[model samples]
Target: MNGVAVGVFVFFFLLVTIMGFAAARWRRAKALDNLDEWGLGGRGFGTFIAWFLIGGDLYTAYTFIAVPATLYAGSAVGFFAVPYTIVVYPIIFLFLPRLWSVSHRHGYVTPADFVEGRYDSRPLALAVALTGLLATMPYIALQLVGIEVVLQVMGLQAGEDASWFVQHLPLFVAFAVLAAYTYSSGLRAPALIAFVKDILIYVVIIVAVLYLPSKLGGWDSIFTTANDSFNAFNKENADAIAAGDAAPKAMIPPAAAHWAYASLALGSALALFMYPHSVTGVLSTRSRQVIRRNAALLPAYSFLLGLLALLGFVAIAAGIKVENAQQSVPQLFEQEFPPWFAGVAFAAIAIGALVPAAIMSIAAANLWTRNIYRAFINRDATPQQEARQSKLMSLLVKFGALAFVLGLPKQFAINLQLLGGVWILQTLPAIVVGLYTRWFHRWALFAGWAVGMTYGTWTAYGVPLPGDPDSHFGGPLELFPGAETTKVYIGFTAFLLNLLVTVVLSVVLRALKVPEGVDRTRPDDYTADLGDEGVEAEIDPHEPAHA
Candidate 1:
């Protein structure tokens, strides 16, 4: 059972648990009974804290596991994560500062809050809120999947013959602890713990990338071994590949899959900031300057991600073999590292899940409290009431994620996350484009979102796994409609169709003089800084959201 490794893992886990609870006291405020304090840590974090928080939030446990796993599985486009992360920084540097400005000026806690204030359409705002909630569920589940993979490699999971509850008892205990501290300390828990999380991750990745390659006969040997393995598999499976019963593995994507690779990278970049957790981290910053500065600095993690992705080849070189590719990295650590350091690696992964899961649950809860509960259920809800609702809903959100991991097949998690990218990207026309112009009719944006969501989901559902035609959502790429040979990311294709529909409908709606909802913001709102008029160091929860 690797007692020394398990002990080290437990020690770090306990340390974070203590920090998570103590975070409520770390940032003492007047009270956490308001969204600003509870959901956003008083919106006073500077560039340093935001850098770690946003880094810990965006680069999740799933990235640690799945990106390497993709390479381990020999998916041609597995390394798309590196390019997408590179692409996202420039995009956020351009627009997220504007979102930060408007959100602070309006006391908007969630993106839906911004949408409703901008468009004055409750239904459209509700759609954005619900989409964030739906997309985030499977995402949180992927974090749990990360934790589960670590536990399995550590010999912490119960035997397969054990009852399901017994089998997942450790996972449930971790979830309960995460839910408790997040509920008690709110955003402060993750914001505080992010410092520790990022440090451990950096240490682990740096050591693994540097030391493991040397131990495994260097990078050249690693790549050669991985390529040879792929070639061997392809040669053995030649008949099956020709009969469309198996995929041909490759070190680099073939010419035929070039569009698929590019589309995945671009599509993921466009979708990254649209996630609620990403917005929550941005909105919690002290100023637009902090957002901009962090946008510039966060690319350091992308460099780390590229190194981490190469570890998949390292695992191959080390002769690490597991039926599940997701387990390869964890298994590699167990086999190669000392028992104690292996524990640290496992703890790094498990703790990595905690930070983002906390942020995601909080982000989802904020959406429910602002757009669903207050907007639809209680028009006169107070700030305290909103905070209370969000706290309760955050618990429910985590539980929903727990249910997802328990009830669903874990193999499809990567696919579901891609599907989430497709679903959340549908909101870009409303949120990102709305930052620049209000030319889009609210109803038209809403219609476009609907079409994109429907098409993306249906198309993803129709894609069968390469060797299993009966399976669904087996991958993110599909044959481009009307181009029999070209395959592209479904999200990118869906987003283009959404833009087309939104633009056409806006033109028609304008010609018909459709009622364009009132925009409560001014041009200056998008450019406002911390010291600007009506922009405060900390948000006033009592102020009317649209005032």
Candidate 2:
């Protein structure tokens, strides 16, 4: 390991920490006394800060490492990330502004708060809040995974027969710093640090894409090498099949792993908007126009993602082999770049983790305070008390994410994130439908959520592992064999099930003359533009700016 590269990473991390603390004063709120200022960056982030903040939040350390790793592992299907991100803008443009207006009007901090106010059902709000908190935990842990992998790649943990504790010291120190500043400054810490993280990430990805290919004999050579390796594996499998024997193990070569690649990409795209942190990013913006403008502009990051995905191909060309596919990108950079540059690349990955991890914790905390603690635990909780409870809860959430990384096996956390997508999508019927019209009955919506949750989990669990006797999420949903097939995404299927149940229940309840809850909003409220009297131009002092 080059000491110089390690020094660069340490130096950059410290710089980000200082920035995090300084953000507490950056916007100079009238008062940083409550969740409004602390949790949502005072919700006053203009176009530039919001751009960087959301970009950093959505495209995280895991994206940096895992996207390329999937590519290197021979699953081009992971490129679904690009298309899903592209798809998300239209969806956001449709609903987010309305959410912002209603949330702004009602002092709603969490999406669950919106559910409570709109549906006037404490149970629905609690359900949404609980879902947000559960879904966020593994995502934060994946960030820690990103940082830990970087430290491991740097050989910081490579001492001769070193204990696991000794190897993970740097990772512990890194998160401890994160926990401290986040507890002190809240969402401002991550928003401030995101600037550095995005810049470094862009530089590393661009440089790697250009430099690695030249050393590895260009793009054509890389593809050819991967194809050749893939064909050899396929031929061996075909021969085994021809001999009336079982097919060879699927090594996740580029050709054979296409289904995994496509499914992961598509599933992740749908799941991205569902993450609470992404919602926090959107809600923090100042206007509907800001969200629309950013939606169109954010595809620039997709271009960056495409370039980042090619690093996996670069690893294949370099013939870099490791037990974990995710480590290939960093290892490829380490092999090709000088010590200092490699350190910069590693720092880019590690810092990328911190931006999303911080925002996720804050979002989870808001859900707990607004929907759970306020609704169920203590209806009389004041804003100051709520903020204090949220701050404490945010710390606890971070520790929970840390436990996911340190306590559980890596695959378990990854799988949990996949399950998280299934869980969060259940909220879409309530959140998205409630944005436009409250025609759907609250009870029907709740019933739909229950059906979707059960069906999605059962389907995912029913999938069997490759060659295993059990049938539970071994792979994705396979509609037909050989000739007829669809292995796209299970969440999409679950969402359909949810919508189906909701619609059917709505009709049944309407015939029965069940009382539908009153909607706090009108038609004009959703399509309302900037400067409309219904929407507030400034963030509420009592609530968060992002809300």
C-alpha lDDT (0 to 100) for residue 368 of candidate 1: 95
List the pairs of residues colliding in candidate 1. none
User: Where is model 2 more than 4 Å wrong at Cα?
Assistant: 158-160, 237-267, 467-485, 528-531, 539-547
Indicate the TM-score of model 1: 0.98
lDDT of 1 at 353: 95
Model 1, CA-based lDDT? 0.92
Q: Report RMSD (Å) for each prediction in the order shown.
A: 2.1, 3.3
Which ten contiguous residues of candidate 1 have the minimum total lDDT? Answer: 538-547
State the local distance difference test value for candidate 2.
0.79
| Residue-level error in angstroms, candidate 2, position 258 | 8.7
Task: Supply every candidate's count of residue pairs whose N, Cα or C atoms clash at under 3 angstroms.
Answer: 0, 15
- Tens digits of per-residue lDDT, candidate 1, 1-547, equal 8999999999999999999999987656757888888899888888999999999999999899999999998988899999999999999999999998999888899999999999999999999999999999999999999999999999998998999899999999999999999999999999999998899999999999989988988889999999999999999999998887888888899988899999999999999999999999999898888988998899999999999999899999999989999999999999999999999999999999999999999999999999999998999999999999999999999998888888888867668987999999999999999999999999899999999999999999999888898999988889977886678999999999999999999999999999997899999999999899978865443533221
Q: Model 1, stretches more than 4 Å misplaced? A: 538-547
